[model samples]
Target: MIRVAIDAMGGDLGPRIAFQATQKILAAFADVEVRFYFDPQHFTVPEGASSNRFTSVSCSEHVASTESVDRALFKRCDATIFRALTDLAGEQVDVVVTFGNTAAMVALTRYIVGLLRPKLYPALIREMRPAPLKCLVDLGANVHCPADMLTGFALLGSAYLEARSDDAANVALLNVGVETSKGSSVIKDCYQMLSARSWPAFSGFAEGFELFDGGKNVIVCDGMVGNAVLKASEGLFAFLLSQLSQHSMDTTAVEKLVRAENRHGACLVGVKGNLVKGHGRSDEKAMVGAIEYGIDIARTNLSKKIEQKLIQQGVL
Candidate 1:
């Protein structure tokens, strides 16, 4: 049985979408199970969610307010999210999925499971995109990072790429150009280190415009830069939508379902648990997609894959 530990309190849709998604998932997969860590009777399943596959656990407390790394580990003991995960222990579930505060998950998971000892601040991000298909790291967990952390991001990104695409060695560091010396000194140094290293198959620096090229799998950068890039991409898309805002565009109710799968978020990779942080302004479709993504991730045992790669490359 594959168990998905969900932070029922997280995300904009809260329990409604979660309940629906849980129902949809259970209906779709027999082995999939959803354990909602929400306030007891906080909400009800939409219509047909009371199946044998879905169960709800009441969490008296909630995740910390801030996105600090400390909050993830220091969450209130009574918090539903933490309680559900605590019960998960080692074998009950596969991954923990959350659309809540990003930093809180990181902090709490690290505190509970400890960092990847060798790669202390391993890059925990999501790359399941629609158009660009970019594996972006540090969407907002850590504002500041060093070279090794960035390199670790590359490794994590490579692991994701190897699992998702045919282009495994196509991983690149986010840069202004494909040159060895590009961007800030820190970035340039990381570029050189990765370009020289044999691990993760670094493909060299990736320019800003080349991010959406679809050939590159991994794009490593600091959270500040990554966040800026994400905003810029969203702004560009919105601008394009405005420019191409058609009066008779494909805005059918069916389109809403497709848009949901285009979720923007990343999963926490380094920690033992399976936690994904959805974009702050996620909709019902995105929320459902996130839940589905959690299911796929849990079934794939992605964390174990990364561990194997890290061990093979001596990163562990």
Candidate 2:
């Protein structure tokens, strides 16, 4: 059985969404156990939570603070990630899912769970946007990177999206242009070097806008560019939503629900521990997906694939 740690106190629709998602996961997956940790802002697990054959942990103290989180992630010394991981260390849990602050999530995972350095290093926020939907690594996972590190990102994105996108061979390297002679000497050299490699068949270069509109699957780039592209895509997604009111076209419920779910989740890649990042404004659907995504990571053996590719890229 896989144990999942969920942060109950997170996102705009906290308590309710977290609760509903937890219920859905537990009901749908019998082999998976859930552990919820929340402050007063989010509801404690219902009365039946404890005896329902699952584990639930609660902390009345609020562990999430917003003001400082934008610049830095929430403190995980004794709250949020740390709390869940404490239980994990004691063999009380296997994976952690939360819609809290991304920085905090990154920091906690890096500090507490520990990541492989030099080879297995780098954390990435991967997602699929509208249009073609590609997975861009190091979104908020790291702020700094090198060519070697970016190559590692390439391998990771490939391993992850290949499975998620139905083995779509649409991987691309994000750069200033689609041309072979684009970007700095570093990127050009990397591209030339990569053109002759044996891994996920390279899909060539992709521009910032092409990162989404095009049907690229995996986009391997530095954390800085990846993060900027992420923010840009997020801004556009929001902008499209805000302008939705101006449109007179009839919208389907599934379309609306899917767009809603997209806002609140990003994958936490590269860790010995199981962790997922969700939107600060996540609702029940988003939180629930985070939990299930973690389960998929575990069940699909994502870590193992990452290990194999990391070795291929000479990162391991």
Best by TM-score: 1
lDDT of candidate 1 at residue 145, scale 0 to 100:
83
RMSD of each: 3.4, 4.1
Model 2 error, position 102 (Å): 2.0
Q: Which ranges in model 2 have alpha carbons more than 4 Å from their true place?
A: 40-43, 60-77, 89-91, 117-119, 129-133, 162-171, 192-196, 212-216, 231-247, 253-264, 309-315
Best by the lDDT measure = 1
Candidate 2 structure lDDT: 0.67
TM-score of each: 0.85, 0.78
Count of backbone collisions within predicted model 1: 7
